[model samples]
Target: MSGAAPMRVLANATELIELLAGEGALPLVDVATRIGVPRPSIYRLCEGLAAVGMVELLPDSRVRLSTRWLALADAARAGMLEWRGAPEVLAHLVERTGQTAYLSVPYGSSALCVDWCQGRAIDVLAYRPGSMMPLHVGAAGRTFAAYGVPLPEGDRRRRTEKTIIDYDELAADRERIRRDGYALSEEDVTIGIGAVGVPILAPDGTLRGALSLGGLVEDIRKHCDEFVAELRAGVERLSGV
Candidate 1:
């Protein structure tokens, strides 16, 4: 809308990607026709992206995702530290809590899961790597809120019956977590699933991400304190890294 050039550029880039995903590469004219933009604009977009290593422009006047993207993907994969004992820790967390365990880091305005493990008794496992949940509807979000992540006003809406809709109420909850060093969520994202979330603090005391355990509400309530202790220990152990 309006003259938001950056937004328009981003939209054109995503549309071009979707087209290329299904149709491979095409010249500026075909790409502009499919995306309903001017050919000159598409050409400029492609050139800009190609300069930044996002696309490769061929002598045949076609374009495709650059081979360099593989290095970027590898870097992102390494960023998760999945190869460096994270999965084992999550598996152990599941065993100790008898609930699904998650490691969610803040990505933009959402909690982005990088790893998880399903517990033995868990019949429902919903989260996985690349899954993103908004910053207002889960234990991970509550952890971000407690640490002053600055969620937008729109995310304060209802996603479930137990989702906190009022900013004042959510503020009080965040305040409690900031004081208590953890957050508990009950039936906020999915009904009947309760969770406890704790922050894995960095050496500088910055919030890295959240580690959470989720399962049936009854079981979660029965072992919440133990789960909290275990989660805190996990954070402390990670902090030594």
Candidate 2:
């Protein structure tokens, strides 16, 4: 097979996995339709995934991810060496602030949430494990920009009325976050939700990831300073500093 053939198959396989992960079991025809692959190709892809133990072919000709993914997920978390101390830090932040805490690392022009601890007060469902937030919005995304990760080009996505999409405004926000050592967002991603984020820096000062607290807009805005302090403390603990 030519190199392109394998790359195409790999891309299709990845898309198939993400589709099943999001939508649960579905008929092979529907999977093909949703993924824009041919029906025959979709079936082959499903068979390949099942053979690899990544997914299961249901009795009704539908398919779903296999239980092996649970083990894989656990293994992935454990394998992320930089985030070795993340779970304890996330738990402590949630306990300290009573808000959802997330650990995200830069992935291309987006922030990929690797782990999170749900808050006691409310669930801010905008970000979760495996979810991606773009670099120009959200506290975690902006923290990457603040730490010198360049933003993706093109008009910024307008997720909410309060989302800052203008390049000049985003430049200012990045500068402020750089100066303050944290980023704060108020209803930028989801209405009525707010967040505070701080970059997790290595001892040599490279960006490791971002730690964030998210909750109700008013609550987050009201306690922004305190949240920044708590998140920084968590980063300190994670870094053993």
Candidate 3:
């Protein structure tokens, strides 16, 4: 094959991988439709990926991630040591606030929970590690959307009836979060739950992740100011380290 042809094929494969990572699973027809490629082209790409163990074809003909990708992710994490300080940070947050603390990053149209530390209380099981959460509803999600990542396109239709839903209202709140250096939600995403979030910025001043504390709305309300202050302090401490 010519050099240009090989480069084109590589680009196509990369795009296919991104789509699979974003959507989790896709059928050949759906992939073709979304990528605007011909069905045969998508089939050939999937076949090549499956052959290399980068993807898998399920019994129902749907395609999803393969173990090879997980291996690669593990290797990358081990190299980067992304979680080197995460455990201690989480423990400190949970101990300081007596509430569940979580770290989340933007993942496609959602926020992916990377790690969590639960308080001594038994009610801290709402958010599970590796869960994908809506970016338009929760405190952490709103902080992410306000910082750079846009809210999910479809969230406008499924407005959060429990809290703020108007796009303009949310946009205004985003401005406040930017100014305040923190974000708060009270019975907004999940009923009876309140949360405070602070953006995690990289040394280059780019948003890298978010840290949040969760608790019962009433309890959070009673101590909202103190909690926000503490959470902000913790984020600042983490940033300096």
TM-score of each: 0.70, 0.80, 0.70
Cα misplacement distance, residue 159 of candidate 1 (Å): 2.1
lDDT of 1 by residue, 8-46 (tens): 899999878656643467876788887899888989999
Report clashes for each candidate as comma-separated counts: 0, 0, 0
Which number leads on TM-score? 2
The models' CA-based lDDT, in order, is 0.79, 0.88, 0.77
Question: For residues 72-134, what per-residue lDDT tens digits would candidate 3 score against the true structure?
Answer: 765654564555576678888888889888878787767777777887665744565555666
lDDT at residue 228 of model 1 (Cα atoms): 92
lDDT of 2 by residue, 153-215 (tens): 874779999999898998999999999999999899999999999999887899989999999
Residue pairs with clashing backbones, model 3: none
- Higher lDDT: candidate 1 or 2? 2
By TM-score rank, best first, the candidates go 2, 1, 3
Error of 1 at 132 (Å): 1.0
